[model samples]
Target: MDIFDIVGPIMVGPSSSHTAGAVRIGYIGGKLLGEPVKKAQILLYGSFLATGEGHGTKKAIVAGLLGMEPDDYRISDSFNIAKEKDMKIEFGEAKLNEGHPNSALLRLEGINGNKIEVLGQSIGGSRINIAQIDGIDTNFSGECPTLIVHNMDQPGHVSEVTSMLAHKSVNIATMQLYRSAKGGNAVMVVECDQQIPKEGIEWLKHVEGILKVTYFAGI
Candidate 1:
């Protein structure tokens, strides 16, 4: 096992799972949205909802959405900063069924009408798992540059995406496919060793059968 797994991340926190991990969750959510967040509806689940306020979970999440890192002292004042930036913020409980206790669901809207829903869980030692995006099940740690594609479940779309990445000299470290049902809504989650250019993303968007494309450089 990695040594850091025992030590945890460097963060301002009373608890690693509640504070630092929660920050990472919000941070990843912000990155997925790929724009300035204008509004956020954060849903806390299980243990998070029970004692998050006392543990600074709420502030950490807001701080993360504002692009602050876990160690950012500004985390304590994130709500004020969000207010100054005119970002609307709200918090509520999530009725998660068979979900991890240290999990959250983030619904975020950007200034330009972009919106994304992210479900993230803090497993332990400040490491987190992005469980879902826009209701599509996904499994990525946000440890590497990731490409998420929402598309129709049709033939050849998978090859098309992989081929595009290959043409750009991007090497896929890991790739996963999830679908709502056969020949229905689907998502392609790819973690890459190399950074993908903006042009590559645009190309993926215009590919026939592709619905939406989102990219996140590892946090």
Candidate 2:
């Protein structure tokens, strides 16, 4: 029960869920990719697939991928902007097995060949839930600096990550862990109160058993 929940977000929108939230989803997707988006494959689901066009959902997503925010007045002109920047974008519908009505899956490729897949949902009032990253189940609001680590499900991995964060003095606001199975792939979604230093991220990349690390400096 906050002001944003009641009044919604200040955005260029015909619908908060479709427009504003779509922008955020794209924004987060871009951040997770870690570089300028060179190509984007956007798949809409449920309500977003049914009525998103009329609500400017497509343009909003493209705008966010171009590094625009929800309140950016240029959202409506995102398609042209993307073309000008040589960003290739494709849109389609997604078949998700039981999820929120306003959901989208984005497959993004960066200029440097970095790629990421993100499944995000707009619950309401411009708030979002990033449900999956690179096919791993995740749960984070993207409201804080988030650290997502993909690693082998083994002993000491969790403690290693936590210890590093503690050493950096970054407080964790919330953390969730998910795994495919015992001794299989695992992911840690850690939302922190402070921005993690670039050196810390680089250090974590070299840790053994760590497969991938994605950090989102909060919007």
lDDT of all predictions, in order shown? 0.92, 0.92
What are the models' TM-scores? 0.96, 0.96
The TM-score obtained by model 1 is 0.96
Where model 2 places Cα greater than 4 Å from the true spot, the runs are none
lDDT of 2 by residue, 157-183 (tens): 889889999999999899899999999
Among the numbered candidates, top TM-score falls to 2
Model 1 agreement with the true structure over 141-188: per-residue lDDT tens digits = 998999999999999999998998999999999999999999999999
- Give all candidate RMSDs, comma-separated: 1.3, 1.1
In candidate 1, stretches whose alpha carbon ends up further than 4 angstroms from where it belongs are: 4-8
Q: What is the TM-score (0 to 1) of candidate 2?
A: 0.96
